[model samples]
Structures are given as structure tokens and as C-alpha cells.
Target: MKENIALFLAILYLIYRYKTYKNVNKIIEDRIENVHRSFFKRIQDVLQCSKEDAEKVGLALDKYFVPLKSKFYKIDNNTYSFVDEGGFKGSFSIDQNYNLLTLEYNGVDLLALH
Candidate 1:
């Protein structure tokens, strides 16, 4: 009788762990679907392209963003850098925490906000 009670408790614990894992997996999957869906949806709306054309659009963006991201840097002095792009002048800052980096543009910085 004692062995039977112990085995029942073990099975219950295993079931609880399995359910928790399944819920986490489901949340991750939902987030992925949102990202992919919105990405293709925006492309289709902007370029008037069909869903079938997304591969080419994604390919072009992949090519463009590689070099575009290189120009940004973090200065140790912790002051914003200002730029004058003729029609636009700007100042910008980067605040980092863990794996996330957020860029904030001061009015003087002609940073591209996208």
C-alpha cells in the first residue's frame, strides 16, 4: 500500500512537468507565428507583392541590413552623437540590458527610426 501511494505521487509529478513543458512550447510557437505572419503581411501590403514573392523580398532585406547595422557603435564616454543629414539633424543613444539593446534618439540626432 505504501509503494502504491509513492508510485501514484511520482506519476502525478511527471504529468505536471509534461503539461508545463507543453504550455511553454505552445507560447513559443505562438510568438514565432506572429513574427512570421506580420513580416510577410507588411511586405505584401507595401510592395504589392504576393505571398509567393516574399522569399525575394526577404533576400533583398537580408542583403541590405548586413551593412546598415555596422555603422552603429557605443561610445564609452556615454554621450549621444549628433548628426546633420541636411534636411534632418539628430542625436542618439543606446541603453543595453542583458540581451536587449534599445536605441533612443534625442531630437538633435538624425537617426533613422524604423
Candidate 2:
């Protein structure tokens, strides 16, 4: 009887561990999705380009610069700035509705270029 109880407890513990693992994975996936929607989707909308182009520009900025942390800063209620590790800089502005008004890279309009 004792051996049977032990086996049942072990099975319950495994089930609990599996559920916890799945929950953690789900949380991680949600966070990643949020980042993508907030960052990359915003870029795509502002640039008026495909998702691939926006991602290419984002990845290029990260990889082309020196191996350091890139950063974004809110310049105003509607504008944000980006600075790469290698001293490259860009900025974008959005309206109250969060629609992108303008995007510039190195003082040039990225939308026009795109």
C-alpha cells in the first residue's frame, strides 16, 4: 500500500511540473509577441513597407553598428529617438492616435527613401 501511494504522489508531482513548465513557456511567448507588435509592427506601419523590410532595417541597425546596446528614447509626447552603439541616430514621431507621422534616419526621411 505504501509503494502504491508513493507512485501516485510521484505521478501527481510530474503532472504539476508539466503544467508549470507549460505556463512559463506561454508567458514567454506572450511577451515576445507583445514586443513584436509594439516594435516591429510600428516600424512597418510607419515605414509603409513590408514586414521583411522593416525587420531588415532593424536588424541591420543592430548588426552594422559596434557590438553594444542600442537604445530608444522618448523625445516628446509624439516623438521617439533611436541611437545605435556606433553613433548612428534616427527619430520617429506618432500622432495622438499612435499613427506614425514621420520617420527619419541620419536627418533624411526614411519614408520617402523607402
Candidate 3:
């Protein structure tokens, strides 16, 4: 029947839309995970704290400064920079081995790269 065919097509369209939505969500999640994982690991190593503790500090900073989720820059092979959605901004550079080399937060150089 014509109605049966139309129903099947509509269902297929819905399924396609759902899958697209899921894929977009996954991409956004992966980007956030990458930003947090590498940057937070550097913070943890430099501060010499447990992963949990470093995460706490990172979360606090995010809460306070409100980083712009979509604004990211690759400073080098191992370093990245980001800007806050609000007033604060910061940047960090890592070494060849992925160690924290420098950190700059809110116009203050927190660490020296060399």
C-alpha cells in the first residue's frame, strides 16, 4: 500500500537523523576529552598531585574562568592554547615528551618553558 511505503520511509528518515545526532555528539565529546586529558595531565605532573586532585583544580579553574569550548589553538607539536568564555585566558606549552614546559594564566607566567 502507498501508506505503508510512506510509513517505512518516514521511519528510515528518523533513524538516519538519530544516528547523525549521535555522531555529532560523539565528536564534541571527543574534542572536550582531548583538551582536558592532555592539558590536565600536564597540570597534574607539574603540580605533583593525584589525578583526582588535578581534576578538581582544573574544574575549579573552568568554573571560575569559563573557557570557550570551541576556541582552541595548537601552539606546537605538544602544546595548545585556549581562551575563556569570560574574562580570563591562559596558555600552556609542553615538551617533546609531553611534559609541561610552560604555563601562562591571566597574564601571569606560571612556569618557564626552558
lDDT for model 2 comes to: 0.64
- Kindly list the per-residue Cα lDDT of model 2 for residues 26-92, writing each as its tens digit: 9988965765445566555545657776565445433333122445666766677777677888876
- In model 2, the runs with Cα more than 4 Å from the true position are 1-69
| Candidate 1 RMSD to the real structure | 13.1
Q: Which 10 successive residues of model 2 have the least lDDT summed? A: 61-70
Q: Any residue pairs clashing in model 2, and if so which?
A: none
Q: Clashes in each model (backbone N, CA, C under 3 Å)?
A: 5, 0, 0
* Candidates 1 and 3, the one with greater lDDT: 3
| Model 3 alpha-carbon drift over 4 Å, by segment | 1-10, 66-114
lDDT of 3 by residue, 2-104 (tens): 9999999999999999999999999988976988776567556654567876566555445444352424456655565667566466776654444455667
**lDDT per residue (tens digit) for residues 1-114 in model 1:** 999999999999999999999999999889646655565455445444467564344333333232111222234433232222332322233233111122333342123344
> What is the overall TM-score of model 1 with all chains considered together?
0.34
